[model samples]
Structures are given as structure tokens and as C-alpha cells.
Target: MSLEIRKIVSFEEETLIEGYKKADRPLRMFAVAAVVTNPWAGRFVHDLKPVVREYGPQLGELLTQRICELAGGAENIEAFGKAAVVGLNGEVEHASALIHTLHFGNFYREAVEAKSFLSFTNTRGPANAPISVPMMDKNDGGKRSHYLTLQFNIGDAPAADEIVVVLGGATGGRPHHRIGDRYQELQELGHDVDNPAAV
Candidate 1:
């Protein structure tokens, strides 16, 4: 089935100053959102896989393409994440159904050649709700410096019968990262940083 897309929203944010100092370079972030009709709103659906399978790839590809364009290219995306917001009439699972599938996430992952899974949030809310997209290093989940969040909202989205799916990216990590990575903390605790299983 073809997706019932209502609208697509694109956002970009750049941090040029950090901690009252000028950044050597801007830290760029991007997000692309698609507001689509919720197929199972206001009702319990025993099966979601059919819609998931049918819609995941298309949504994934469309959003990833916009992200790449906004970030200049997939290779420039150092951190990435996703989010979904279901309208009041829908379940949180309705939002998840569109984004949590491998069929949906793989497009962005493969495009950026990432090693870490895409971080995500699935929630239910009203129109114009805060859309939070949490991100981490595209290649390294333990990289504390690359943790990021993108926040934006649509004024009239997910109108009690819609879902908003989003994909987000960052050009690089924090402008001045003083804190070390997770590996350092792990090593301090006497865990084998190189061999996580041994810990």
C-alpha cells in the first residue's frame, strides 16, 4: 500500500559558538520528518507487520535522501538517530512500526556506512509536540563526545490520525569535547575495554 504522506519537514541547526567561545568550525545537525496517516489509529491491530513491511523501505529511503542532501552527503554525517511521534488517537507502537524495522533503518545506516545501530524514540503526543531526536556516533556507540539531540516541531502535524517519522544527523561531535569516552570509564572500573564480553 502507498503511504498516506501528509507533509515533509526539513530542519538544520548549526552551533557556531560553544561555552561563550567561538567554535573553530560549525557543528551542523539535520533532521527530516514525514507526517503520514496512521493506518491503525484508534483501534488495536493484531498485525502490523504487513504495513511495516510495505512502508518501511519507502519512508527510510525518502528520509535518508533528504538527510544526505541537507548534510552535504552521507559521508559527512558523523552522528545519526531517528524519532517517531504518534497522534493522540494512536499507540506509541504505531510510531515504532514505521521506524524500528531493519527495513527502515538499514537505508540510513548503509548510506552513512555506520557501525552502530540508529538510536531512537517512539512516543505519542498531540500536534505541535516537541520532536526530540537523539543521536550518537554513527560508528561508535561509546563515543561520548558525539552524543547529540535535534529538537523541532510541526505546528499542525499528526492531527490525531497521523504519525511523524524523523531521521536526524550531525556533521561532527561537540565543538570542544573535554570529557573522555566510555572506554576510559570502563578501563578505570577494571573492565577490559578492548574485550567487552570479558567485562
Candidate 2:
């Protein structure tokens, strides 16, 4: 079955000053979402394979392209993530199915030339629900400074039988990041920097 898309929304913001100080460089974050009709809503589907397979690539490619364009290009996106919010009538598993697959995530990963796995969140909510896509350094997950969350909401979306799929990106980390990275914290804690599990 073809995915029935209702509307597409884009969110963009640039932070020039933060924490009462001017940023070294303006930080920008972008996200794009698609509200689509849920094919399996209000029903129990033992196997979601067909739906997932059919929708993943299309949603991934569509959302990834929009988000990249919002960021000016994949090169400008240093941190990235994905999220999905299923309507109240649908199961959270539906949200997870669409975004957690390789078909969906590989597009963004390849586009950004990222080494790290795409961060994600999947949940169930109603229209105007808060959508938060948590991101991390495209190449370095341990880089705490690049940890970010792009937040937005569609005034009318994800109706009882709909799902909102999203992709997000950030140009840089928090403008006033001083806490250093995960590796540094490990070293300070006397843990092996190379092997975090070793004391």
C-alpha cells in the first residue's frame, strides 16, 4: 500500500548568543517531519515486515532530503537524529518499526557520511504532541558537546490514525559547552580511556 502523506513541516533555528555570551560561531538546528496515514492503525498485525519495508525507504529518503536542504546540505549537519510519533490509535511499535530499520537509518547515515549510529526516539501521542529528536556527533558519539535535542510540534498532525516521522540535524553543539567529552570524563574518573569498562 502506498503511504498517504498529509503534510510536511520544517523547523529551523540559529542560536547566535547563548548563556549570556556570544557564540564562537552561530549554531543552527533543523528538522523536517511528514504526517502520514497509518496503514495498520486500530488493528493488531503480527508481522509488520511488509509495512516497514514499504514505508521505510520512502520516508527515509523524503525526510532526509528535506532536512539536508534545511541545513543547507549534509556537510553542514555535524550532529543528526530521527524520531517518530504514532497517533493515539496506533501502537508505539509502529513508530519504532518505521525508523529503527536499516532501510530508514542508512539513508541519513550515508548522506551525512557519519560513522556513528543514528540516535532515535519512538513514541505514541496525539495531535500537537511534542516531537524531540536527540542527536550526537555524526562521527563521535562520545563528544558530549554535540549532544542536542531538536524540539518542535505540528499544530495539526498525527491524527488518530496517523504517524509523524522526523529527521533532525545540528551544525554544532551547545554554544557554551565547557564540560568536555565522554573520553575526558573517563580519564578523570581513572577509567581506561581506551576501554571504558575497565577501571
Estimate every model's Cα lDDT from 0 to 1: 0.94, 0.93
Q: Clash pairs of candidate 2? A: none
Native-referenced Cα lDDT, model 1: 0.94
The digit string of per-residue lDDT tens for model 1 on 1-199 reads 5799989999998999999998888999889999999999889999999999999999999999999999988989999999999999999999999999999999999999999999999999999999999999999999998999899999998799999999999999999988989998888888899886676
Candidate 2 per-residue lDDT, tens place, 72-153, comes to 8889999999999999999999999999999888999999999999899998998999999999999999999999998999
Model 1 pairs in collision: none
In Å, residue 171's CA in model 1 sits off its true spot by: 0.2
TM-score of every model versus the real structure: 0.97, 0.97
TM-score of decoy 2: 0.97
